[model samples]
Target: MKKFDVDSKEVPIDILSDYILKNPEKIYGIHHNKMEELVGSVFKEHYNCEVHHVGMSGDGGKDLILIESDKSIVVQVKRRQSRSKTETASCVRDLIGATLLNGSRDCIFVSTADHFSKQSIKHKEDALAMEIIDSFELFDIDKFMGVLNLHTSEREKLWKELIEIK
Candidate 1:
């Protein structure tokens, strides 16, 4: 099994998949909280957003908070060891509740599992139907956001330099 530096700002998608998605045997050894950190870092690097880790106890179902411009998006991360253990509707409901409670209309549910239960997908659709949430994106391993853009990398480097100077 391959090891990962969870604290790194850059995480290759293949490495993430090897441990979290493609290899079932390796998944059990993966640390759930560290996976959340990796996901948060990926989002921070890819979107150039301020990603905050909040996956501890009483996090209100949100693992990460992504702030971009004036919008704050709640993110829920699920690292399922078994492929059969899909994210359920209740998870979606809790995320919906959390999103509203956080005063944000947008949320994203991320899971290492290959897919979510049908009920979960319907729940997300229902939330949109009722206009309770402006956006509810469900991302499985294959559906994660794409690679970081060049501009984002440059921005990250500049930010690191500024931090070093301070």
Candidate 2:
């Protein structure tokens, strides 16, 4: 198994890959639910902050909402691949725009694919009236798990052998 530390707390792999990947039946004999579950698990480990998952189903373009103490962070998970760089940048811009419309200045975008852009980073600062979110970025399943004080090890190979259906 993979191991690490998040905000002095140790988050297991269960809260990372199994939940974020939305595939638990093939994992630890359970089901995975809530986009916030993945987000919460990460922020909790990284910052030791209180968090919740609003989810994306019927909630428009947002996936999760994370709260760190008094400040609230509006989060969007782009866990799918984009056909091209333009599409990727558009998705990030759209997420930021929607969060701004909702009056949240702190916007975070998480994706399974590489969606990092220079334009997003350039807009990290704003006037006193607005909150500028350059980006709260995360990429790759392994890195996500790392954020949660978790890891995927050689044990994953064994898991695949045992869990793969015939």
Candidate 3:
């Protein structure tokens, strides 16, 4: 077992996993609120930013709004409900639209999908956000643990845990 941070404080992944597994209904409660809490928690914890969730009714293509210092970042969290490239590209298009609407050049598209299509990736590079991070890189403990400087045997544990929650 290895620790990961939740609020700038390190906590073990296995302990977190056990909590979710034992109280599966708690996962249901989180999903009802969408991943806004998860994304906001991570960003706020790691980046020291204030995050606001714009609800579904009129989100303007952005789900979470992050503000740090003078910089404001618009984030669109793609839930990976569909596995189609067209759908993924469409989400990219929405992020571009969000940039246009928000008048912010700094935008990000985060998704649970394994990866975006080349078209979506290019579109992200060209029109919309400057960054795209999917489940593989974001949740892979081995990869991200390097960023966090933590070593762990549960490489894909976060992904599996989040998917189970979802």
Best by TM-score: 1
TM-score of each: 0.72, 0.55, 0.57
lDDT score, residue 113, model 1? 78
Q: Residue-wise lDDT of candidate 2 within 1-166, one digit each (tens)?
A: 7654322124553544544345422222222233345555566656567666666456666766667777666777654333123225566667777677666766676654434565554443331125355344534334554554343333456688888864
Q: Which digits, one per residue and each the tens of the lDDT, describe model 1 over residues 5-105?
A: 63333556445544444344454345787678767867786667999888988888999999999999999998776655688889999999999999999
Question: Residue 81 error for model 2, in Å?
Answer: 6.1
Which residue window of length 10 is worst by lDDT in model 1?
144-153
Q: Which pairs clash (backbone N, Cα, C closer than 3 Å) in model 3? A: none
Q: How does model 1 fare in lDDT?
A: 0.76
Candidate 2: 10-residue stretch with minimal lDDT = 24-33
Ranking by TM-score: 1, 3, 2
Shift of residue 91 alpha carbon in model 2, Å: 1.5
Put down candidate 3 lDDT per residue, 38-118, tens digits, no spaces: 555556655578988874767788887788787777877654443332335677778777766776656666654446677
Candidates in descending lDDT order:
1, 3, 2
Provide the lDDT at 65 for model 2. Answer: 68
Each candidate: what lDDT?
Answer: 0.76, 0.52, 0.53
Error of 2 at 111 (Å): 0.8
- Winning candidate number (lDDT): 1
